[model samples]
Target: MCSSCVMLFNEKNGSILPEYTDLPTLQKGEILVKNKYTTLCGSDLHTFTGRRKEPSPIVLGHEIVGEILELAQNEPFYDLNGNILKAGDLITWTIFAATESDEFVKDKMPQKSASLFKYGHVQFTEKEKFNGGLGTHCVLKRGTGILKVPLSVDEKFAPIINCAGATAMAAHRLIDEIENKNVLILGAGVLGLIASAIAKQKKAATVTILDIDDTRLENSKSFGADNVYNSLNPIEELTAITSKFYKKGFDIVIDMSGSVEAIKTGLKFSATGAQHIWIGAVTPTENIEINPEVMIRKLLSIKGMHNYNYEDFINAVNFFEDHFTDYPFGTFIEKEFPLQETEKAFQYAIKHKPYRVLITI
Candidate 1:
């Protein structure tokens, strides 16, 4: 029997106090993983500051890497490589744990469908309390797509694969291909930075990023952004500067900032037969007006993506395996906080605007 466990409980008013709960007994189709690293993402910040509504007193976090603690016997479960999973293996799973088969899952878009049981976005009940990466141990229920991580991938950089890396990979699917295309990215956050690097690796001719944070913009340089611009400038000035690369607009536009103004300005620069991907508006904000005529004239296609599917997660792991050693991916983790100091870590990340503040379990 498992004993009492500790987790960084989200108290909303900027507190991640350590809370204790009894661990649930493992059952068929259930697996338990000891937490290694849990990422504090932009969504966590929104929930921390009360901008996003969530169940109070819940354990909050989803981006995670953990070691297999226990697994159900006789359960038909396979890792990404079709290898049978066993205890002591390092692994991560998709954020969405589908409760039932549905059309969406059949269509390969399980991120937001089919009786979702989202890690870190759920409230704990008496039956089973821990549900997120902030916990000492997290439950990976049935239907979760578990993937094995090779020893080559550092634990620090692997957690973001569930969120940042896969999300970018999903967004990249918006365009037919990235090679030789001129790409524009808005926001120098984790997703934008990774997508930029991935696009560059795919041979994008010119990769430009627009963001207000100079520090983050500078950080994008190492990640594959060919050019960085301050979006704080007037829309026309931003347009003119971006236009110098391609007079009309880029072949592909990716918006990770979710700013209405930025979207409006970015739309103007998309070339004929272009693809625009919107991913960063994870939170609802003020809506902006746009001219549909541009879509009509340029034959532009806009795609909006949320959390990624399982295949993207697998691809993310491959991307890390190929590039983790070469790029400064691990450097994004600026500081680490113990499980109990999650509140402090969130505050530090907010104040310093570091690439990411991690919860090291």
Candidate 2:
């Protein structure tokens, strides 16, 4: 069988070439999936705009949802919940696959394992042309963490569960608990909004979000953000607002903006014994200085998460399935394009800067 796909020939040219390749025979423990919907994530935009570089002729999309097309013979495949997988089931998988022997797995950072194979970032070859979300099909390799999405979950929203949603779950995991805590999320993007909702659901005392975009901050209110601030405002104004609600400072601060200024301001808002989780600094940027004396006096704990682990993915799926109706997850994707218009989709996403842009296969 042949599958259609769009490949990035060069980052310098920013051209996406459409191509078709013969699907390879499924290996043991591998499953073929028909791409249903794929969303253009922030990292994908970075690569397309040459802000980040990836190998040429690579398929670049990781936030994806698909349906099982075929299952390898003689080997039983199971999802993260241990349920047996079969053809026709809707599913999504971890962005990277790691082996048990991976040293990072022992260190509890499987996403950075030595043998990690990340989907959507690999250079396309004849044998693995369908390994990314921009293609009509994808082959779930061995050791990949798979999840069977429920029929009730919208196809458009499911694609993000494995990426942004899972990363938010991982950030919260680092905080350990949220009940009765004042939580402040930096950035009102998808990750920050999702984090706000999760904090409220976990019984946080207050949930606040900060973003430069007023529109996005308004949207945050519907997603469980009790207070929203435009960080672009004057520093004194922001400080006054924070003083009004966060009298004792926030007990938990999560940075999803990757902005040095935002992180610096967030650090100042940290209450004594606060926990800070940074998930959005995946790219190179200017560093922000921190005072060791302040950290020592406040007893702040800071941690960073990259991609997510299997457990985080599972929690993300469950959270979406349980609370899909509670929030407007559908509104995130402002526009959609077909596989043939994948390039246009990226262009629209870049120009409009919508929360997400979808490519349906």
Q: Per-residue lDDT tens digits of candidate 1, residues 130-218? A: 78888789889887888987678888878899988999999987679888888999888888889988998899988999899888888
* Candidate 1 residue-wise lDDT at 118: 89
Provide the TM-score for each candidate, comma-separated.
0.94, 0.96
lDDT of model 1, residue 144: 85
What are the per-residue Cα lDDT tens digits for candidate 2 across 112-197? 98998898998887666777898888888888899988677888888999899999999999996789888999999999999998
Model 1 spans > 4 angstroms off: 1-4, 8-14, 234-247
Name the 10 consecutive residues with the lowest summed lDDT in model 1.
1-10
C-alpha RMSD values across all candidates: 2.2, 1.7
Question: What is the model-wide C-alpha lDDT for candidate 2?
Answer: 0.87
- Give lDDT for model 1: 0.82
- What TM-score does prediction 1 earn? 0.94
